[model samples]
Structure formats: structure tokens, C-alpha cells
Target: MAGSADTLFMPITNGEIPLGEGQWLYLGARAIDGGFPDELRAALVCEQSMRGAYLDLQMRGMNVSPRVDNTDRFSGALILIGKHRGENETMIARASNMVSAGAPILIAGDKTSGVAPLRKRIAAFAEIDGSLAKYHATVFWLRNSVDFASHFSSAKTSPQGYQTSAGMFSAEKIDKGSALLAEHLDENIRGDIADFGAGWGYLSAELLNRFSPRTVHLYEAHCASLEAAKENLSDYDKGQISYYWHDLTREAVGKKFDWIIMNPPFHEGRKTEPQLGVQFIEVAARSLKPKGGLLMVANVTLPYEKTLQQNFSKVNQLARRDGFKLLKAQL
Candidate 1:
């Protein structure tokens, strides 16, 4: 329900307000153009890797951070927010917490994305000053009052026996595709292993509980999800688990892994792009040691087999159900 990038950036392009000089934090900034100011020291906080990569390519000389968690404390500056479904309330609370009192906050999104409701919610903590409606998108500005401690304090728990937060993929329950992949995971998975795009430590926890691997590395892009993963996996052997807040498409770990498990993301926003999965496969091939293996799950209709064949010496389908396929590949 989010508007196009152009629609979201219309206010900035139209010269509504000058993006002053300072440390600016951009929350949920998907791939957009023309709104960014060149003069400001901007840091973009995006949860999706594809959009982060695209914004990195477009915005040179800007700091591109992965996610906006509670630990991130910035103040006395402007914060731009691009609203999206499932994460609006969390984001507003986070923004209220991060920005200092009297700092400006700007929010832009389409009507379908609940911008009006968000405006109502934000009004409780900040005073709305100005707004613009154009191209089916609404852009509004407010000043933070620093009085929102009661709205957001703890993470949400799921029936799957793990902690998750708003905006995480399948936070309410275990994803069917992930469940399918976890069921077919090889019991012989040993040595150091990595899970790309790990969400809330589900697969990593399962792997550690089922196999006697020396170490397990979990790479996740969303800050809330990674924090929840840390909480969910706290009871496990701490020395054997590692958590990274990283964008897999741009950053790579230094060493190769004995095995890799992935549920690579395939969408930029709402649009499906199989190339994202293809890029994951390419990265997996490069990050694996000689004869190392990869276990992946994807939609059955996605053309990942061709990319797998090109990247690995062997590729085979291990299981398929409910329009999803579990694949195993080795070099």
C-alpha cells in the first residue's frame, strides 16, 4: 500500500523545507530519489537489503546503516520516515525515542499505508506543524516532545516459542517456507555454519539443537529481528552463536563456512525480483569452502535452479510441498 518512490519524495523535490546541515537519520528509507539533501550528513536505516543497496548506490557519501534499534540514540536533528505496513507503530515509537526534544520529524507515505492514522498517533507526542498532499502521498512535519516511553517498551512473543517484534517477517508465527526448510535440514550439518537472512533465530536455534556444529553464525538485516534473535537464543551456548547486523548483498564475512542455510528475500518492496535470490546464490557460492554445502528454500516457480547450477558443481531438490521447494547444492 506504500506509494511509489517519486510520490514519497515529492515534498522534498518541491522545496517544502530545507534539509539543514547535521546528522540526519532516515528510518525505513526504501529506494527513493530527489528527497535527500546533499549538504547534510545523512545516515539511512533500512531493513531490506535490496532497497539498502539501491539507496547506497544512489546516495554517494552518505552513511548507510542497516537498521534502527533501541540502542541507536541520535538527537537534535531531522529524521525522515517512510511509512510501511506492519512497522508504522514501532517506527513512530522508535523515532520518538531516538530524536531529542524539539527535533524535527518528517513522515511521508500513501493514504493506503495508514499515514492519516500515523499522524493521529504521532500527535500525542509531537505537534504537527505543516503538511503537503501530492501524487497520492502525504508528507507531514512535527517536533518531538520526548514523552513516549509507555507506548513501546518490550518485544512481542510468539506461539513458536521465540521473541519477535513488529515488522519482522512472519512475526506472528513461523513462516511455512522456513518450517518446510527446517524439517528437511540435514542432520549431518557439522562444523561452522551460517544462516543468511535469519529471522528471530528460528532456523539457527533449530540447527544448534539438532546438530553438533562447532559454531553457528546468524546474519540478519532488521535490527529488531536481530535483537529478538539474541533474546530467543540466550539460553543456548553463547560462545557457539554469533549475531551480525548486516546487509548480505553488500557485506560479506571474511571466512568461508562449512555449510550455509538461507531463505533469501526475493522482493524489494511489494514487487518480486528473483534476482535478489540469484544474488544470494552467487554470494553463497563465493562464501563457501571447497565442497561446502548450501541448503535453501524458495518458491517453486522461482528460477533459482539455473543460478544454482551455474554457481555450484551439484544441485538437487530435497523436498517440495505447498508450492515451496527445499534445495541442496554443493561445490
Candidate 2:
């Protein structure tokens, strides 16, 4: 959302969370195993923004979409909350819009995802039906009396002059590493460029404003962040920028670039996955021109140095500050 279910449908197994008969909206949906009610599965109009999860649902034969359609009417809803609180509320707001008052909105998540306080937060707005705790997780259903879901604004403009939506990394403020990287991008960086894992187009927007590149290819995994990137970088989209809603770890970019810049994500859920950043380095190594180079920022402790050295013919530490290190690698 393995590792995430085998902990949402527990309430369904027990009988405390009763879903409605017609199409049910499922926010942040993913593949589940062992004892998911088949009727509920059939009724679910599953919505997942992450490309990998969306494809996983499709592969499992579940009805899934990257985004929700307003035209669809749902009798009830199920939400599997994530680590971001604003994004969870955004999902709840959308679910409120899909179903009428008194329709059940069943929400489930682990404590690390902050289900306890989230329940309290929503209780201030709507009415709770019932709750259960299992597998270090909590599942609760609440009647959606607040159907209109009054203007919960999840989108905001950062001081960096770009639009960011909820759930994106560093949505409200510039990430310190990215800000440092943006400040330190090589003055000589020109021509075709790529921003791997571009979230809300912050780095790309900075690149477009500070330097003139022939084109900038932005690759991001999340649909919402990619959508925000499109909106944030609209001015540069005339011909200077191209967006790809892609899982870069599993797929490679088609066109090679003169320079690749990134502030790669290392966290997968609560666990740190260094291999993801390694894969990103491999992608950058392959997707750059023979004489091209990479510019990136990362935490000083991340184990990417060996990967960089292994992939590129030459690697250097550009600068180190604010607990981050900037790297330059050329093939």
C-alpha cells in the first residue's frame, strides 16, 4: 500500500465494518491477500496515485484508477491511510464528495501512519461508527455527515515560487538538500537535462529560471506530484519541458540527457531502502550521453558513493554542507 495488508481488511474479516452494496471508493488501494471479501473487492473503484501500486492492482484484476472520477456514485468508501496527514485528509475529503451523508467511510492504518490522532481529528468533523485494533493497526468506520467537506485546501504555493500539493515531499517548504542543490547547480550546466524523481517541479522550476536548457525531462512516480509538477512548470512547458509519470526504478527513460540532476528519495514507508537510490544512479548512468554528467544531492550518510563510483568513470564531491553532500559524476 505485503507489508501494508496483511494489516486494512481486518475489520471486514471481523464484522465491525459493514460496506455498502454499490460501487465503493477505495483511496490508496493496493493488493491484499487472504480473506478480502470478494463482494467488496468487486464493488471497489480503487484509486492509487503511485504507478507501481496502480499497476499491481491492475495485474491482480482489481478495478483501479490513478485518480477518482466525480461522476461515480459510491455507497461507501474504504481508505488506507499513508504517512502524510494532509494527504489522508485529502483522501477523506474526496471520499466525502463521492458518497452522501450517512454513507460509511472505513479508514485503516498503522500507528506509525498516525491513525490514532487522525481518528480524533475526523471525529471533530463527522461521527464514528465503530473501531478495532489489530496487527499494530487501527480500523475505524465513520458516517459521513459532513458530506460537503468544506474547502479543505491541500494545495499551497511555497516560498520557492512553485505550486505543491499535499503528499509530495517537502510540499510546504523547500527541502534543505534540494535548496542546497538548487543553489549549487553547476553554472556550466546547459543543454538537455533530466530531473529524476522530480516532486512538484521544484528543482525543475529552479533549473528553468536560473539557466536556459534546451529541454528538461521530469520523471516522477506519484501521479499527484506529477500533476502538480505539470501545473507548477506550466510556463516552461511550451517546448522546454516534458513530464513522465513513471516508476524510474523499474523503467528507464527513453532519451539520454547532457546532464541529470536529482535529490533521490531513500525512504520507502518507514524503512530506509538504499537500493532505490542505487537504482536511480544506475538509471542516470545509462540515460546520460557518453560524455554527459550527473549532479545530485543526498544525506551525507547515504551509501551512494560506491554506486556512483561503480557506474560512472569519474566521481567527485562537489560540496558538503548542512548534513548533505553534492556529487558530480561523469561517464
Candidate 3:
């Protein structure tokens, strides 16, 4: 579904999938080539953060906040299933509930994303209207009904005290790189701080445990993960925390900080995009005071040293172990 337009749009193009006369909802809608037709009233519910997709959606003037206040009211819905099984199931469940009974809810995904099992699973419970195959992907529609709500609303089980959702960086446990950086953090990290891509609040919580910074901003791109981070760090004083569900690469950080710490994401879909971390480095540089410091961890193989050197006045490697490297970049 990443680059294949036909998977979701073919039916609409071929006139098999009819757009609602009123509003329709899009769940986890990735980069649509040119976005939906002008006539269609599309509402988006995207939780994951792909910088390019966010840019595309923003350019289309469809930058709806991921947190929709009143849900389960759209006349029809379309879900672009992602690679995470739990996320896919949760989106499908939310999609099913969004549209009413007998309204269309189309699920689109490629073969490699485990679309077959999901199709079968939903077919067993929901009323399958029909399906079409193209570009090694399947697009199937099921009539919305409350009868199957509990089955598909979400994937249930999580280990004890887990505070993350599916598809987030280090969702299941503390990331090794983050953990290493947290362990080796300077004892005097006490000024205005920012965690660039704070995932599920692990490093933020660690920072709060160690120091009482004036303010700790948690900038995360994924809405669900941001929500989880909120819960994970709920016990902390309100004034000490600021959470921003934002596109780190495309958006400005608003204010400069005394220090920035992160384990920046280096992935774009199924590919390793080292430039992602590069962009984060650039953003950190722009959002930090001249005397500020940046502490981050990365995979040993990711090529970030040159970018770090170019952006920071001083860059040094603090530690390297377990296939991860910890670096400090000072302005």
C-alpha cells in the first residue's frame, strides 16, 4: 500500500466503490498520490508519522488533528492497514465503529502486510460485501455493524505494566540505545530540556527521575505513542511536562532549549532511512541555545557523524556497545 495507488483507489476509479454523498473517514491513510478527488469529503485519522505523508496531507489542506473529539459518526470509512498487527486490528475496529450498519468500510493492504489473515478474520464476523485484488494487494469492504465491535475494536493483550501501543519505537520494552543513553546521561542535565522523538516516555520518565528540569518537552510524531507517553508520565507535575504530537522534521520546535536528548527514528516504512536522524539533528541544532548540548543514541551503522559535526560546534562519541553508539553534540 506504500506506493501502490490501485490498492485503495482502483475501486473508486472503476466506479465499484462509491463515495458517500456526505462525509467519509480515512484511517491510517498513507500518502495518496494526489489525495482524494476534490468532490469527496474526506476526514483523516492518521496516528503514525511518516514525514513525507504528513507533508502530502498538509499540502492537500487535509491536516486534521489525529484526536477527533466525536467519533463513530462518519457515513463511510476506509482503513489502510499497516504492518503492525495490533495497530491494524485497532484501526479496523475503530473504522467499523465509525461508520453505521450497512455503511461501507473498506480495508486495504498489500500481501506482505498480513492482509489475508485480517480479511479472513473480519469476514468471519462482519458482513463481507465483496473484495478486489490488484498490485499484490487486497481491498475488501465490510458493512459496519455493532455485532462485531468487540472482536475488532482493538488487539487486547499487553504484558504487565506496558505503556505503549503497536508500531511505536521500542513499544514493547526499553530500547537498548535509549536505555544506554539514559544510563550514561550527564548528572547535571537540569535546564530546559527536550526529548526529540520521545517514544512512550521512557527517556522522559528517566529524565524526570534524575532531574527536576524547569520544563521537559516531549516531541513525538505518533499520536497513539504520544497518548501512551502521557499516561506513562501522568504522575509527574503538570508544569514540568509539555507533550507535542508533531512532525519533528517539518514543524518548528517553537522555542530553543538548554539541552536536547533523543533516540531519533531512523526508519521510513520498511527501509532504513538514516537521513531521518540527520533531519532530527538539524532540527535539534536549530532549536537549541548556542551553549546547549545534544545527547543521542543511534545504531552503530547509521551515518550520522558528518551531519552531527556539521551542525554542532563540538561533537564527541561518549560510548559504543551492544551495536549502539552514544554521542554528544554541543552548540
Candidate 4:
């Protein structure tokens, strides 16, 4: 599978297609790249390029899409395939730091999202495989499962710091509606900014310590919260913060923002899909610049303020409490 020739099947979004055939599947991120069912794109075939993976529908507000950009066209064993339990502990900690010890590692997902309690905690030592896919469920392990550094160690969760392993997503605290929308940010939010779903980075460190934005793109589409927001924005300034795994509702980062903070991710995991917060309020009003603004937050009976007033003409709520609210708009 170098520069590419053939043999790259890759389909697993409405899964199935495996009985037998020339095997030319390529439907990732759940068919038609996440929006699914465009007649399964005529059951696809003639492939030259078809890459996609999931979760970035505006910061882990996933619907799946992203996985085939051909990262150097791999060449080796690092099997941690399938399932989407918040991307299986950052795909098993980057497949145990890029496999190299007896290789062949595998782990699948969707067994009610826990992969059956993570295959009953990596079942003894590996060689485990649980199947059942009426809708979703799978697990397969090999790289000495129980000794993958003793049941996958490394765990740190603070008042929202970083370091998380063993399947992500609220990997312990700091997500109470994103800490109540990071204490209602808005220190009058200055220039270039963005934090839409910057999950494990705690609202991009509260918008870089209270609206210190000159540039702040924590975009995130969950590769374990963009690897914990790139180690929590790695002590800032690589040009005033940057960390984009992308997927803010299908490509459009034409770059143009005055501010775009968000707590907008009303369930895609437990299934409450408020149209994934109205597709991140219509892709944050097409990546605002005009009247530039979008301070969303949700939960207080999520309808998303009539789709943020039909995609940001101007909607406001500012703050609420317990049930959650926040929501400020402009564009």
C-alpha cells in the first residue's frame, strides 16, 4: 500500500459489504463521508482517491468523516482498527507509540460505545475478539493486550489540564457544558480566534487566559481531542496558538474569524443530536468575518435558539445555569 496500486478496501460506515466480491469498498465515515446515504454513491467503485475518517463535526460533535489523507502511506503493523469510543484511547495511545514490539495490535468499537467495557479491560492478555454488528460492536486485540504497558497506563485529569489515555471523551471531568462554557468567556474577545469544540483543551485555556486572541484555532475533531489539544496548546505561541485536526462540519476553513468560541456539541455520543447543534450554527455562520461573532453554549432545552436565529442574524442568551445556556451570536 505504498504510493497506491490496489488492495485498499476501507469501508465501514454502514458496514456489511463483506460477504464476497472483487472487494472494492471505500465508504468511510459512515457512507458518503458522514452525511451518508446518497444512495451509497451508487455503491461506489472506480476509486482513485477516497479518504475519510470521523468526528470533527465541529469538535467531537461528530458524525464521522476524516481518515484517508494517506499519512505517508503507512508501512507496518499498528492495528487498532475500528470502533469509535471517542477514538479508543487516542487509538491506543497512538498504537503504543507507533508499534514495534510484536506488532499486530487491534481493537474495535461501538459495543454500546464502551467496546464491552473495553473488551473487559483488554481481556487477560490479548487474542480477544467479540463480534456482533446489528448496528455496531467489535473488538480484537493482539499486541500482548494485558501487557500493553500493563492495561494502558498514563492517566491525568485535572481542573482541565491534559494527559489522558484509555479511551477519550470527558476522560474524567472538565466538561460540565464545557465548564459552563468556560465561565462565559467574552472578555470582549478580540481578533482572530476559534475554539469550536476544542474539547480537552478547556475552551482553549479559556481563550488563552481570557480573550488573548490574536490567533487561536483549536478546531479539533477528536484524535483524542486533537491529542489533548496538542498537549494543551503546548505553552502557547506557535503564532499565538494553533491546533487543527479540523472537521467543523465539512471543510471551509477559508480563514476569517473575529471570534467563534463554542460549547456547541449537544450530544452525538449519547444520541440527542440537536442536528449537531444545527451544524455548528451553520458552520459558525460560514466562518464569520462580517459581523464576526458566535459565543454559543447549549443544553437549556436545546433547540439552539431556532438554529441560532436561522444562522446568526443575531441571537442572544448570554448566561443561564445548571441546565446550561450561554449562546451569543452576530455574523
- Between prediction 1 and prediction 2, the one with superior lDDT is 2
Candidate 3 structure lDDT: 0.78
TM per candidate: 0.76, 0.92, 0.87, 0.29
Tens digits of per-residue lDDT for model 1 on 235-299? 88669998887777877677689999999988765578999899889989999999999999999
lDDT of 4 by residue, 67-95 (tens): 33323211222223333443455455444
Best by lDDT: 2
Clashes of each: 0, 0, 0, 10
- The regions of model 2 sitting more than 4 angstroms off are 1-7, 34-38, 147-157
CA displacement after TM-score superposition, residue 181 of candidate 3 (Å)? 1.3
**In candidate 4, which residue ranges exceed 4 Å CA deviation?**
1-111, 115-192, 200-227, 230-232, 235-257, 261-268, 275-290, 294-306, 314-331
Residue pairs with backbone overlap in model 1: none
Error of 1 at 169 (Å): 1.6
User: lDDT rank, highest first?
Assistant: 2, 3, 1, 4
C-alpha lDDT of all candidate models, in order: 0.72, 0.84, 0.78, 0.56
Best-to-worst ranking by TM-score? 2, 3, 1, 4
